[model samples]
Target: MNKETNYQKALHCYIQASLNILNHFRSSVKEIHHIGSTSIEHMDLPGEVDVLLLVKDEGDLSKLADHVRGVGYDEVEDFSTGYIEEVVLRHRYDGYDVNFIMMHHKSKRKDEILYCRNRLQGSEKYLERFRQLKAAYQNEHINGDEYQVKKSDLFSSVMNMQGDADVV
Candidate 1:
């Protein structure tokens, strides 16, 4: 499928997943954000919808994890260096992979997450830079650690420039 087609499919999957999450979590989640490659328009398609689920507090993390598993989401064992204690859950929705990143409402990485998404959504320069990085190291199985660090640095550099190092 073409980029537009892939984006459309990914978006459809995000909407479906978002609705299901809302129906299931309801008041437990403070906010739900559509993030990552699929959320950015004109960016290279990853075909996976990355959802940020901000719960009201740290206590909700375990609850959400249990809820996700009960609802059929498998916990993805991510080896990437994590900036915070966040829960990563994955499930296939309409053939597209939907990743749910559950974190506390006051997590330090919250701004970074929103900033990255907003930057990519609004600025073509940053988006192209990100696209180039992803194009070079999209195949993670071959260069997992390197790819993760570089991707993290890409965001960290952007955050650092704006004096948002607390989250990096």
Candidate 2:
């Protein structure tokens, strides 16, 4: 199939996955956003979706963990930004790998996450830079962690340039 066909398929799968999660946690979540490369238009990605789930209260973290686990999402990790907590869960939905990131509504990390996503969405220059990085990572065949670190570094640099503190 052609690249556009592949991208269309991936985008469809991503949206379906997002809807499934949104429906599952309709009452528990404050907001849900499509983040990461899959959310960016024309960005080439394997069928994976990054979802950001904001909860109304901090106490909802454990409840969400249980809720997601009951529905087949495995707890990927528990991470934080010193003052705020974030939980990551992963599951396969409709042939798409979905990374569900849950955080409290008050977490400052949310701003950073949205900012990075919006930056990529708003600027072809930033998007092209990210694409180049992804290409080089694929060419080198590095592990996923290494690729994440490189992406984080690139994002951190961008955030710093805008006078924001480094997030990753």
Candidate 3:
């Protein structure tokens, strides 16, 4: 019998998803980055791939969202924040829940997100610790806005571990 795992996906699946988005967004997208737990080697994930897409500051997000949804990708509207908005898209590809973040090239938050990912990949010890924190959060039954807030907290903790960490 073939069983599907609820959480965790092969790293390459996430990579391909990023590539696909990159291709679709081509000239408009400056770059696409792989992030989240899945981006960290050998780490258990919730089958969700977090990808960051860098676009021009004036990029039309609604159009992009419509385009991605037209192509059969799921849109995650729950990820936007006030002051600085980030468009997040999700899709289940090859059993992986892939998420794409549409961000502007000059956004400070974009740099912070990239920094957090780098920090996570830099230390095996810290990565394992973060895995545990994520595992514990799974049992907390958090949802929507709270989940996003908690995720920010997780990133902050991870960055702080590296000492003198910046925003996350």
lDDT of 2 at 24: 79
Q: What TM-score do all the candidates reach, one by one?
A: 0.84, 0.80, 0.74
- Poorest stretch of ten by lDDT in candidate 2: 76-85
**Candidate 3's residue-wise lDDT over 12-123, tens digit each?**
7766787787677676777777777777765655646778877764555667767888999876765546325777778877767778887777888878778888888777
Stretches > 4 Å off in candidate 3:
1-9, 80-84, 139-151, 161-168
For this target, which candidate reaches the highest TM-score against the unseen true structure?
1
The CA lDDT of each predicted structure is 0.77, 0.73, 0.70
Residue 72 lDDT in model 1? 88
Q: Candidate 1: which stretches are off by over 4 Å?
A: 1-4, 139-142, 162-168
Clashes of 3: 0
The full ranking of all candidates by lDDT, starting with the best, is 1, 2, 3
**Distance from true position, residue 60, model 3, in Å?**
4.3
Ranking by TM-score: 1, 2, 3
Residue-level lDDT tens digits of model 1 in 51-70: 88899978888987898899
Q: Write the per-residue lDDT of candidate 2 for residues 21-48, one digit (tens) a residue.
A: 7687777788878777777766775546
Clashing pairs in 3: none
CA RMSD, predictions in order? 3.6, 4.1, 4.3
